[model samples]
Target: MSPGLKFIDFSIMPVLLGAGSCRRFLKTRMLRKMTIKHYSSNRRSNSPDNQYSTIAEIKEKMMKSFGLEPGYTTEPKSREELLKYQPKFEDLPARSMQDSFSSAIIPLSTDAVLQDKYINFRGFARLGRLLEDMDLFAAWCCHRHLKVPNLPEGVPLPYSIVTVLVDRIDFTSVSPNGTQDIRLSGHVSWVGSSSMEVVVWLEQVVNEEYQKITRALFLMAARNATNTAAAPVNPIQPANEEEKVILAGGADRKKQRQILSAQSVFKVEPNAEEQSLIYQLYKRTTPVEQTGQQRLLPPNCIWMHDSFQMSTIPSFPEHRNQNNTVFGGFLMRSALEISWATAFLYCKARPQLEHISDISFQKPVSVNSFIKMTAYVVYTKENYLQIMTVAEVLDAYTGSRVTTNAFHYTFSAPDPVTEVLPRSYHDTMWYINGRRKFKASRG
Candidate 1:
């Protein structure tokens, strides 16, 4: 028999009852109850012992709470098959948002064997790993809402999904330990002709109450399985007033994105409003002589090149997803860490990710290629620090580099930040764009 084949016994069982047998069964039942009670008592709310003391304890608690394990069955059952144990029929309409709304509650955990790699320097869960999980959840949400293809049945065509952009992610707060129960919920916020907006929210459950922690907006695109072109998706009909508002917001954001893309500071010329602002900024600009402690001009101003930090790491196969490129979540995590570290050093205090916007995936980084990431402090406003991070693929032999991603982060520090000034046109472009993104992020 092949390893892929699993078998189940269908033979009937004969039952024999005796006084001693009944007593044994009762004893087993009582023991199981006592064990569960003991476990529950030890992990009671507000108990110091409830917290995870080590990685092994976290793994044990998560396994008992969520029963999560890697690897699925040899082949996954289709949505219809899993729903009713029936084969899928031909010519089905696209799925609806309600079909994709899913929720789960579980205590966070670190894999015992891979604990070091899954945690950041602060001993908390790595943002990159969480991102990977969120990406998977978003994909599943979209898949659940997809209509069955209208094709002859033999083998279904492969499904292709990619995350084109992450509009905004706000990290309000995070638990310091993995012992807290986290509630994850997501649904399709809006649908375009071939695109979808997935709103995923992460919250921590404390004392039977939910506390919002983080939320992210992801823009995903569906493509034809054969040609990899834009594929038609089911149109979403807003079911209620709340949904109507959410859909309207999504549409408005889409429109704003289109307009901004065309009028971005990266262009050669600025618009009338931007031109006026630039003129005022340069005309009133006071040149510092690179001296005087209280001047707050030259000393506070950090050059993009001087403030730039770089890290080189190889793209391992473990980071690849079904699309055969590096996972977006991993990239996000790595980029965020670098930016946070830079912010932390500059502020002389801890910095938290207040907002991340316009994370664009320009291209996929190939497996086995070296990824060189650069982080620069693009702008600063009082307590807010904006860092622009770029990820590129570096060819060692040719010494060539090609950009793969661009991420913008706004971090709030405990103390005020020394303002950064753009000395050149290129730096000014980033500064203007960063300010624009900051405004949009506020909305």
Candidate 2:
């Protein structure tokens, strides 16, 4: 979208490009079948009654999963019905802070567990949150062009749609009638539709409170793309930040380099294989509850290999500050480097790798934090790779978080990338958002 402009949605739903032309999307068959899958699962329960996860049950499971505070009973709303306004956020009481998922929390009691710092838990929660948000964001973007309107921004994304949890939650201090600064630092390394890879670093500050989120920014990079000699006639574009620079150089060689400055792949959404992954991932994993809403979490599993260690230093000197601390630009640089590296590692299995198209900073991170970064190669095909990464900023002294972020990257193989075919999942998501009724498979 004009190089710098981007669309940022706070909820999870499929994305259709708002700043581009859907007509351009119609000419290609492979583009028609692309889908972004971020999470993974194998077992799904078909019991209609079972799909309804109670807030109490979600609370029990979450507490066990991440040491998070217990669930609170908010006034419940009727299901399958759309909302006309924002939901009321009632204050939760101190007693509701108990660990609902204690079986999962059992390990935290051991000396080895308390001091042991693991980042996988954050990855799980981040994956769930990103998928939920993708559902909303993507739907909203494509709503108008497809004849479906989407929810306005700044509203509460339904608990039925998205849920969030941190690895080490502290409610004992913040629960009891006291104001505390709740630090949430986490990152989703590689994300696609339905799943993600993430890590959460958290700390509760007594007498400190979390600032409510108000806005967000999304970034995309594309320039390096290799089209197969079989279809060499089709136009190809760059996919990585570096390729973009090279493209610009080539374009500048001929003229202004305007064409090369433009992004190659124009959109991001859930593809068929990705959708299958999502369906399978949630098929059996227990869901979390909040305000009487049942929300699903990524099933506990090792989807990405632990090949890289978290780095707090920037790869280059330009990113360091006067205090020798990493700057925000440096953090972003590190994030992309790590994400590309992780994606490259996964692509090695197939002897191929692609680049990222979009990135978003949910919040700011700082220096002196032993950041735990994770990335997932959620969606891959013959030549392209789509990766999502999450980075959590932490205060090493107390293991508290500075903030959270989610990034979406698109890569095209030596072949062209594809788009998703629309279905019921897309329709139901729109129905809940009070959007215009869609009649076609516009995915």
Best candidate, TM-score-wise?
Answer: 1
TM-score of 1: 0.73
Backbone clash pairs in model 2 (N, Cα, C under 3 Å; residues 3+ apart or in different chains), count: 70
Per-residue lDDT tens digits of candidate 1, residues 332-414? 88888888788888787988778889899888776778998888888788898889999999998999999989999988888
Model 2 worst lDDT window (10 residues): 95-104
Cα TM-score per model: 0.73, 0.27
Q: Can you write out model 2's per-residue Cα lDDT over 312-339, one digit (the tens) per residue?
A: 5413333322212343434444565666
lDDT of 2 at 293: 35
Q: In candidate 2, which residue ranges exceed 4 Å CA deviation?
A: 1-277, 280-326, 349-357, 412-443
* All candidates: CA RMSD (Å): 14.3, 26.9
